[model samples]
Target: MNLLHAYVSGRVQGVYFRGWTRGHAQRLGLHGWVRNLRDGRVEVLASGPDNALRELQELLYEGPALSRVDGVEIVAMADEEQPTHGFSIAPTV
Candidate 1:
């Protein structure tokens, strides 16, 4: 299993980015959440098989057609409590 923390920048807010993320994550069978941060970036944390996680990261770059994803910053989240079911859209933080 792998855990990943990602921050997607550039016009991520008000674009249904969180919903878009959840759809892809769930499709990949990842258990995690995506939410809008106060700073305008979309935050994503997910845990699943390594391959699925990698695929998610790539899909994030494409996002929804209405979005303009400028960058995706990835970080390794170790020893964190990850979700155990389907992906979800979390409240903004």
Candidate 2:
């Protein structure tokens, strides 16, 4: 399993980024949540197979059609922190 914690910046909020993330993650069979940050960024935490995580990382760079993703900062998390459920769109933090 692979765990990815990412902070996506630039034109990510107010554009259904969280929804898009949830759908994509779920389709990839990843487990975790995506939410908006108070600092005009989007935060995502996902866990799944290595290939799935990598594919998601690539998609994060593009984001939704209405978004202008500038960058994505990703960190590998410990397996112990991985979630054991479906993907979701969390409340803004």
Candidate 3:
């Protein structure tokens, strides 16, 4: 398994980014959550098979049709920090 912690920047807020992230995460059988940051970025944390996580990372770059994703900064997380189950869209923080 692999865990990914990412911050997606650029025109990501107010564009259904969280919703689209949750949907894609769930479809990929990833566990964790996505939320909007006060700094106009979108934050995502997901854990799953390495292949699945890689696929999801690709999708994050494109996001929804309305979003203009400038960049995605991703980091690998230790297994202890990875969420165990389910994907969700979290409240803005």
Candidate 4:
């Protein structure tokens, strides 16, 4: 198992990015959260198989149709990030 932490920027906010992310993550059998950042970015944290994590990163780059993803900055998370059971939309931070 692995975790994926990504900060997606550029036209990411105000779109259905979080919803889309949650849907995809669930379909990929990942457990995670997606939220909007105050700085016009979307933050996603997912835990699943390594391949699923990588796939989520790619999907982050190609967000919802209304989104124009300019960049996705990936970060490594500590094992303690804590994996929950299901994907959901986290409150914006």
Error of 4 at 9 (Å): 0.1
1-87, model 3: which lDDT tens digit per residue? 778899999999988999999999999999999999999999999999999999999999999999999999997667789898799
Instruction: Give the TM-score of each candidate.
Output: 0.93, 0.95, 0.95, 0.96
User: Per-residue error at 78 for model 1, in Å?
Assistant: 2.1
> Model 1 off-target regions past 4 Å?
none
> Candidate 3: lDDT of 66?
94
Which run of 10 residues does model 4 get worst, by summed lDDT? 75-84
Candidate 2 lDDT score at position 83: 85
lDDT of 2 by residue, 1-93 (tens): 879999999999999999999999999999999999999999999999999999999999999999999999987667799887999888888
Point out the higher-scoring one by lDDT: 2 or 3: 2
Give one clash count per candidate, in the order shown. 0, 0, 0, 0
* lDDT, candidates in the order shown: 0.90, 0.93, 0.92, 0.91
- Please list all clashing residue pairs in model 2, or write none if there are none: none
Ten consecutive residues with minimal summed lDDT in candidate 3?
Answer: 75-84
lDDT tens string, model 1, 5-60?
Answer: 99999998988889888988888889989999999999999999999999999998
Cand. 1 Cα-lDDT: 0.90
Worst 10 residues of 2 by lDDT: 75-84
